[model samples]
Target: MSPAPPTPAYRRLSVEERRAQLLDAALSLFAHRAPEEVSLDDVAEAAGVSRPLVYRYFPGGKQQLYEAALRSAAEELRHCFDEPHEGPLLPRLARALDRYLAFVDGHGAGFTALLRGGSVAETSRTTAIVDGVRRAAAEHILSHLRATDPGPRLRMTVRMWITAVEAASLIWLDEGKQPPAGELRDWLVEQFTAVMGVTAARDEQTAALVRRVLASEDG
Candidate 1:
């Protein structure tokens, strides 16, 4: 018979660590549920802490906590398009889309509420946070296109693609994440490629970008 093993000592979390832990717990709940559907008790249970402790950290109660979680999700979505300038544009975009789609899959419930709107928790502040993420994501994608001064047509095309990706992601979540994430990501990349091809026909700047992207891939 084996001897009983010692139970690990439980160390107290510092304020920052405790706050981060609570936020993580809240995010996980929010990931699968609407903000109105989640209670502070749920967050406390998820974090393995007491309910009053959750209130202690978030004095303004559930509203404050929901806003904090919203900001965190927004920040993550904003960075989803960030990729190293090390490869061909198409491949790099595919990698970014993989990260983006993974976030969508993990945060399906919260994402649907965020983008689809009409939630009780939706406020101007939350709306601004979501809009900021969209702008930041567009900026990141534009950077990869090497477009420092993209013309109107090129800019509009990129923005349209961002909107399309967001809409497609919402539909994917609605359909129970069908067709596989990889398939969705590859299809998005192809859509971007095709759109760029069409845009290049009428826009010199986009045409130059297409040429540069193709040249990099051939290298």
Candidate 2:
């Protein structure tokens, strides 16, 4: 008879690695289920660890784990809009939107819980995390637009578009992710152009941006 395969070596995880593993597991659970519906045991099972192990890493229990998971998820959400400064602005924006929406698709329930509010796990910290994503995304987009010194109108326009994107994402999830992601991304890019066009009439900064963006696309 063939000899049994040798047992794999038992490797222990480092402190930071273990913690990250737990956070990743917690986020995975939170992705499809509301935080309130997830427990430490759920996280432990997902991570292939014990409940006490989870508690050891997050002594504050479920709330602590939930907060930590949100922080992790926040980082990912913020990075979704981090597009390189190259080529046409609309194409860049489209690529950014694609990432953002993919994240929303993957973290459906968690995204809803974070934005819809009123979750048992909801706290000031969680709200701040969400707000931080918004601010970071706005900054990244403004950077892409070369609006380092954005006027109030331009800033408001960008922020409003951000809000609209969030609302649309929520609605998209509620509608069972219909209309396809690519179509949604294109619609959002078009919306951005339209809003920028309207804002250009009153904001010289925005007008210059419209011209520059259009010229680049045309080129």
Candidate 3:
């Protein structure tokens, strides 16, 4: 009998490695096209594998592939939230927020895909992911505040401040990413520090007025 041809290097990769390779290719396609529009053949071609091989990994088909991509994105986000932040709370908060923004900028398509995938049915899970990140940031802020300014209302105030930051970040990203990344980073720190009683509120009010004027001109 004739000797069988050796398997390709990619095919020789471990199951986990192969799955990750397929997902990376699938994610790139999803970025360019919506999940529903991506075909198995397209993914196979992108991954340099056969249609049957793609099917073998994704037995249930395109939906399974999509879920895998979405899950990967979500897990990455969750892991980011679990990172440790050292130093004063406000600085830590700023760093965390910056990291989150950077993630969104780099992975906007992944974020969009996970959000539109329709698999994340639990509102609490979404809130947990969102609020969990903010809470970690807020904790650092609150810790820094308590080190100097002891108060009864600081907790509530810090929570509100974190909520504002989370909302502002989403708005900033959604509305054309204005103010540039550096400016936005400064603004986040200024806003958080002001809330913690380190900086004056006048600056924040002034910034708000500027935003309003610019928004009016755009409209």
Candidate 1 residue lDDT tens string, 30-127: 88888899999999888888889999999999989999988988888767777888877789889889999999998889888888888888899989
- Arranged by lDDT with the best first, the candidates are 2, 1, 3
Which residue pairs collide, candidate 3? 89-140
lDDT values for all models = 0.88, 0.90, 0.63
After superposing candidate 3, which stretches have Cα over 4 Å from the reference?
Answer: 1-11, 116-176, 189-219
**Each prediction's TM-score versus the true structure:** 0.92, 0.93, 0.60
Order of candidate numbers by TM-score, starting with the best: 2, 1, 3
Clashes of each: 0, 0, 1
Q: What are the clashing pairs of model 2?
A: none
Instruction: Give lDDT for model 3.
Output: 0.63
Q: For every candidate structure, what is the RMSD over all alpha carbons to the true structure, in angstroms? A: 2.9, 2.4, 9.4
lDDT for 55 (candidate 2): 91
Estimate the TM-score for candidate 1: 0.92
**Which candidate comes out best when scored by lDDT?**
2
Can you write out model 3's per-residue Cα lDDT over 1-219, one digit (the tens) per residue?
997776453458889989998988888887656576789999999988889998999998887787676566656554544435344344444566677777666665555544443433224454455455556555655443432342445556667776675566556656877778768877977775565453224344334433543454355
Native-referenced Cα lDDT, model 2: 0.90
Candidate 2, residue 48: how far the Cα is off, in Å: 1.4
